[model samples]
Target: MSLTDVIEGTRQATAADPANAQVSFSVANTLVPGTATAVEVRVRDHRFAVDEPAPLGGTDTAANPVEYALAALGSCQVITYQFWAAKLGIPLEQVKVTVDGDLDLHGFFGFADTRPGFTDVRITVELAGPADAADYEKLKQQVDEHCPVLDLFRNPTPTSTTLAQLTG
Candidate 1:
């Protein structure tokens, strides 16, 4: 089918129920439920306080640093794909993301010349549903192109840090 046909079909499916099609919520959490006695998220931006988990290396159970990276990439892919699915009206039965990264302890601990973080990362996505191969490929391309995390990874932004003391 032509690109227009594919897009039109997806639209038809998504428009069936706009209300239940999706819900929006800002996701921020410190840790999994039951793992900690209390969770607190401190936003320096002064918006509001949210109950979030303590630092990863803290006494409380925390997801490893690598897991956090995987989570970010995986979440970005899933959300990006879902958004397109809803907009295109594609019947997305399932979307699975598996991210893997490799690093060396020597580099991480600062004994080596390599970077302290992940040297390489791989994000694999599996979509379940019925659609032509070309259509599926197009969907995958769009998701990859639009995924925020992927864009960030592909074209990294510079970061700067400053130290300050809080006065009481």
Candidate 2:
């Protein structure tokens, strides 16, 4: 009868059935040519080539995992900037960030490969806003301190991993 009633009806009709809920499973799979072949990594229902160029020979993406880490930081910086811009009522025309890091190819801990972890990272951001340089600089400082992801990365957190077996 009312707008709220009509909207609620539409929402209920479109919502998934709670009685027969669906569960999502995350899994990773990889296949290579042979013992001589390169490595491959597959995850989240997508496959990627570990050796040659993807699609051509395969999805030979950039450095393993490191690329993802860089992207994560860059994305967080952009999102944080946007959040502050909206809160301060600064109309932003564009927001951009460049994240770079260095690592030794050799694995640490005297492993098979002596790849070194990221030694350093640099992030550069560009934002267009009505706020003056002084205000923008202050906001940038605040964002660096308040951004959760940035803080987490800046100060490493201890973590543990466990493998669980599912039983039916």
Candidate 3:
């Protein structure tokens, strides 16, 4: 089965049952022992480490959380471009995304009033295909409107935190 077919099938199924369109994802993480800022993350069957660079007091074992966020945005943009191109019947031979984000450590350290997250992010999408510029522009518009990670970055999401105690 082609990706177009799969995309259309999913669209039809979701249209028939709106509940099918709503889904949730989850991941688990634990702080690595004897590390200042290293964590082990579990997503389904996959496992990876997340840590800051040496300058941030971590052992520089892996990409930091902010880097992961940028990666998520870039990867999501690529996926959205492919799916939108297929759904719109636009020929997409290749797609590449580049993401960059700016952060200020003063916020994390509480030394200043700056926000503790990315203040600005930039994304560049390189597309290669037979489609004309207009078609590509249309695809870009659709992707900008539909990409989940982009939405997460553009809009504020309500979040809550709870404290749990573990006893041995």
Q: What TM-score, computed on C-alpha atoms, does each candidate reach?
A: 0.64, 0.59, 0.97
In the order shown, the candidates' Cα RMSDs to the true structure are 8.9, 8.9, 0.9
Q: In TM-score terms, which candidate is top?
A: 3
Residue pairs in collision within model 1: 10-88, 10-89, 30-52, 30-53, 39-52, 40-52, 41-52
Better of 1 and 2 by TM-score: 1
- List runs of model 2 lying over 4 Å from the truth: 1-59, 108-115, 164-168
Misplaced by over 4 Å in model 1 are 1-60
Pick the winner on TM-score between candidates 2 and 3: 3
Q: What TM-score does prediction 1 earn? A: 0.64
Clash count, one per candidate: 7, 10, 0
lDDT by candidate, in order shown:
0.69, 0.67, 0.95
Q: What local lDDT does model 1 show for residue 160?
A: 80
